[model samples]
Target chain A: MMHQKMTAITALEHSVEIKAVSKTFGSFHAVNNVSLPIRTGEFVTLLGPSGCGKTTLLNMVAGFIDPSAGAIHIGGVDVTDVPVHLRDTGMVFQSYALFPHMNVFDNVAFGLRQRKFSKSEVTHKVMQTIEMMKLSGMEGRRISQLSGGQQQRVALARAIAIQPKVLLLDEPLSALDKSLRAQMQVELIEMHRNTGLTTIFVTHDQGEALSLSDRIVVMNRGQIQQVAEPIDLYRNPANGFVASFIGEINALPAAIYQASDREISLAIGNIRMTAPRRAEWQFGQGEMVQAFVRPEHIRIATSADAGCNVVTGEVLTHIYQGSHTITRLRVDGLGPIEMRLPGGDVVGRVPVGMPTQIAFDLSQVILLADKSS
Target chain B: MTRQRPFFVQFLVPAVLVAVIFAAAMFNVLKYSFLEFVPGSLNVGGFTLENFTRINRPIYYWVLLDTFILSFATAFFALLLSYPISFALVRAERNWVRSVLVVLAITPLFTGEIVRTYSWMLVLGSDGVVNTALKSLGIIDRSVPIMYTRVGVVIALVQFAMPVMIILLATAISQINRDCEKAAANLGATPNTVFWWVTIPLTLPGILSGFVVVFAWTMSAFSTPQLIGGGKVLMISNVVYLQGFSSFNLPFAAVLSLVALVAALGSLALMKLLTARLEQNMATS
Candidate 1:
C-alpha cells in the first residue's frame, strides 16, 4: 500500500506551484516575488511573524486574493485567473468560518451539494468525513452549540470533505487556547498523515511550525527567508531573523579573526571563540558576523575544563520550566546569555549572582552575516 | 457614590416631570376616545362608545385596511431599494465612494416631510418631471396619474423610510463575518450562491428588523399621504387628521389615533414573534 501510494504521489507533478507570485496594495507590497513548489502530499508550513505576507501568499493560493504578478497552478494546471470556487482549494480560516446557521452535517456537505452530488452520495461522504474528524455524534449540532474544539473539527471536516487539490490552513489554531491548540496540532498531524493531501499551513508561531511541519518556509518582511525541513531549519537557519525567530538564541556580535576550511576563529569583544566553518558559510577573514548560540547548545563548565570557546559569567537567574531549567547568566563582553539544562540539574548548583564558567558547543553554533557587512 | 447622588437627582427630576406631562396628555386622548362627539364643537360631551361604533362602518374599515396595505407596501419597497444602497455603503472600497453613498442615502432624512412631499408632488404631477420626461421620450401619449393615487403616496413613503432602512441594513451587513462568505466560496459555492446561502441567511435578522421598523414608521405617516394622496389616500392618520382638524370631531379622531397605535404595535409584536421563531429554527437547523 505504501509503495502504491508513493508511486501515485510520484506520478503526479507538484500539487501546488506558486510561480514568482507578487501581491501589491498601492504602495505596500504584501507579498514580494515568492515562488514555491509544493510536492504532492507534502505538509509545508509558511512560518513567519504577523504582516510577513504568509497569509497573503496562502490567500493567493486559495484564490481569495489574486496576485498582482505571476501565476499559481494547482495539480499542474495554471489557475491564476480562476475564481475561488473554481480553484478547488480548501482553506481553514483562523475564525473557523463555520456557517453558524448550518448544522455540522450540512457544513460538511456544502461542497458536495454545490458540486451537485446526489443526496445519498453527499450523505455518505459527509458522514464518512464527520466520522473521520471524530465528529460523528455531533453531526446534528449547530456550530454555536459545539465546543471550540468541535467547531474546529467541523471546519476541518468541511474543508477536507471536498478532497481539494491543496488544503490551505491559515493559522487555524491561533484562536484556540494554548492546551487545546497543542492537542489539535497533534490531531492535525494525524489527519495530515492519514489523508496524505498536499497542505500549506500558515502561522506566526515558530514552535507550531517546528512541531507540525514536514518542511517549513520561514518568511520575513513579505519574503521567504529559508525553506528546509524542520530539524534542519532549527539547527541551521539561514539568517539572523530565522535564527532568532525559530527559538530563543543569544546573538552576540563577533568579528571573524582567521578563516580555515574546518574552523574559524571569532572575536567577541575581548574574548575569542572558535566555530566550525561549514561549507555553506561564505565569509572573508576579518568580516563582521553575528554568532548565534542556542540556549541548549551552551553548557555549564568549570574553570578546570579546557576549551577554546569557554567563557566566565555570573549566574543571573534560574527559571524552572518542569522538564528543563533555563540558567540565565551575565557573561563578560557578551551581555546576557541563557543556557538550558535538562531537569533541575543546574538549579541547585548555579546560584544567582555567583561567577560560573560556560562553554559554547562550537559545532552547533550558527554564524550569520551582519547586515552592515 | 454620595457625591454622584445630587447629579442623579437633578437628571431624574426633569425626566420624571416630562414623563408625567406626556402621560397626562395621553390620558386626555384616551379619555376623549370614549366620549361623545359634540358635532361642530371643540368640547366633547358625556362618555360614550359612539366614536368607536362609528369606526365599524365599511368606509372606515376599508380605509383601515388600505392604510395597512400601503404601510406594508412602503416597507417592502423601501427594503428593496435600500438593500443595494446599504450593501454598497458598507462594501465600497474607496473612501469617496462610501462617502457619496452615505450622503445620498441619508440626505433625504435631513429634508422635512412636508418639503419632501411637495418635491414629490412636483415630480409626480400631471405636467411635472415624470410626465414631462415621459412625454418627451414618447413612452406615454399623456401623463400617467401618480399624484392623488396610492402609488404616489407609497412612492413618497418609501423614499421617506429608506434612510432608516439603509442604516439598519448597513449595520447588519457590516457585522457579518466576511470570512463566512469567503469560506462559502472556498467550499465551491459560486458568488451568487454564497450570497443567497450565506450572506442573506446571516443578515436575515437585520433585514427583518429593518422591515418591521419601516413598517411601523410608515403606518403612522400622515403628511406624505395627506399631501401626495391629495386627501384621496385616506390612511388611518389622515382619517384622524380629517376628523380632528377638518371636521372638528376630536372624539372620533382620538378613537382613530388609538386604533392606528394598536395596529402598529400589534404588527410589530407579530413580527417579533415570527423573527424569534425564525432565529430559534436557524439555531437548531
Candidate 2:
C-alpha cells in the first residue's frame, strides 16, 4: 500500500501520467492497458515494432485518441476528457505537418496567434524560435520551397514555439535519409538539453531509441515488454522477445541437468556447463530451455581450453564489416551460430568449410523456457 | 527518352478530330456574326457590322449584366451548399454513409438538364412543395413568389452546379493531409480556428477552381432560367434563343453567342490570374 502511494505521488510529480490506458477499434485492441509516468524534462522513448501500439499510446497522450478505459493526467490534472485543443500539448508528426499553406514565419507564429498574444510578443517569440531552429532569414519561404531537413526544423520550431506542457514526437526522423537522420538525432538531443521540456518520442528503430532516450519503453503486440534505461534494456531484457528485438542474438536449445538455488547445470549436444541461475526464472531439473547469447559473447577457444562450454562447428561464411567480422558457423548438432571476431584475428583464421572450436562465456548466457516444450 | 513510343498516343488522334470539328463550328458562328440578317429568309445577306452595333443597345447590355449576376449568384450559393456535403463525403467513417452521400451529390448529374429543371419548376411553383410546406407550418398566409423571379432561376441554377462543385471540393478535401488539422489543434487552436486557418487555406485552390467552373457553366445556362424565369428574367442564352428561333434573326443570335463566349473566356482568364496568385500565397502547388 505504501509503495502504491509512493508510485501515485511520483506520478503526480511527473509532467505526464497515463494510467491503465487502453484503446480498442471494433474487435481489435490497438493499445492494451498500459500505464506509464514520464517525469518533467525527461526524454522518454516508446520503442516498438510496427503495430506495437507505441504510436497509439502517444496519440492518446496527445488527445488525438481517447483511451477506452482509465484516465490520462497532464501536470497532475486529469485530461482524459479534454479535447486536443485544450490539452496544451505540442506534437511533431512523422510527415512534419508544417502547414503547407503558410510560410515559415506564419507556421511558427500559429500557436501564439491562437493564444491571442500581442503582435509584438508573437513576433518576438517566433523570431526567437526560428533563430533557435536555425531558420533565420527563411521566414518568407514556403513549405515546398524548403528542403526536407529545413521543413523538419520548421515543424520542430512551430511545435516548440508554443512552449507546451509536454512535447510528443512521432517518428519525426523516419522520413529523413541516413546522414540527415543522424544529424537531426544529434540536434534533437541538443534541443532536449537546451529546452529541458518533457518529451515522449515514439520510434521503431532500436539504435535511435538507444541513442536519443533517457529511458525506453519496449512494447510488443500491444503490451509493454520492458521499461528500462537503454544500457539496462540491452544488457538485461526481461524476455526472449526483447532479447532478440533489441540486437542480434543467437538462440540455442539446451536441457537442464541439475537445479540449485544459485546455480543450474545445462546440457547441450555432448557438452555440459553450469551457470548461475537467473533470479527471475524458476526451472525444474531436466526442463528444456533455450539459451540466448549475443554474437560477441562467444569467442574462438584455444586448443588447451578443455572442460569448458565448447563446441565444434564448420565455418559457413565470414562477413567483414571493416572493424570486425561476423563468422557464421554450422554446428554439428546445434544448427547455425554466429560470433563476432576482431577484424585482425578474423581475416584468415576462420575459413569456410573448416572446423573451428568456440566457447560460450557462461556469465553472459540468457536462458528462457522453451516454448516448443 | 530512348524507349519505344507510348501506346496511348494513338488515342489522341480521335481527340484531335473532335477538336477540329469544334473549331469548325466556332468558325461558322464567327462567320455568321459578321453577316447581315436577311428578313423573311433563311439565307444571310452581305457582311456588315450592324449585328455588333445592335448589341450596344441598353436591352442587350441589361441581359448580359443579368447573366453575369445570375451566374455569380449561382456559383456562390452552390459553393456554400456543396462545401459541407463535400467535407462530409470525404471524412465520413462508415462506408454506407459515404456511399449515400456520394449518390445524393452525384445522382443529379446523370439526369438530363431539362428534366432536372422541370423538377425544380415543380418545387418552386406557386403551389409547390416548398410553398405548401411553409403554408402548412403557418409561416406564411400566401405562397411566396418563387417562379418567374431571379431568385427561382438562381435557386435552380445553384442546384444544377452543386454536383461539379462537390466533386472538385471532395477531391481537394481528400488530398489534404489530415495531419495538418491535427497539428493545428495540437498547437492550441480550437476546431473552429483550425477550420478557418488550416483547412480552408489548404483547400483554397479547389474552392477557387470549383467556383470558376460553376460560374462558367451557369453563364451558359438556358433551360432552367428560361422555364423558371418565364420571360421575366432574361439571360443572354434566352435572348439568343428568342432572336434566332422566334424572331428568325440568326445573325443577331450568332452575335450574342459570340459575345457570351468571349465574356465566359474573359472571366475564366481573369479568374485564372486571381487564382494563380492565391495558389502562390497558399503554397498549394
What candidate 1 gets wrong by more than 4 Å, as runs, is A1-10, A256-264, A275-287, B1-9, B277-285
User: What is the Cα-based TM-score of model 2?
Assistant: 0.93
Reproduced native contacts, each prediction: 0.74, 0.83
lDDT of 2 at A95: 93
CAPRI level of candidate 1: medium
Q: Model 1, residue B84: displacement in angstroms?
A: 0.8
Which window of ten consecutive residues has the lowest lDDT sum in model 2 chain A?
A1-10
Model 2 misplaced regions, further than 4 Å:
A1-12, A258-265, A274-285, A303-307, A344-348, B1-9, B280-285
| Cα lDDT, all candidates | 0.91, 0.91
Against the native complex, each candidate's DockQ, computed on alpha carbons, is 0.52, 0.61
For residue A349, give model 2's deviation from the true position in Å: 3.9
How good is the docking of model 2, by CAPRI class? Answer: medium
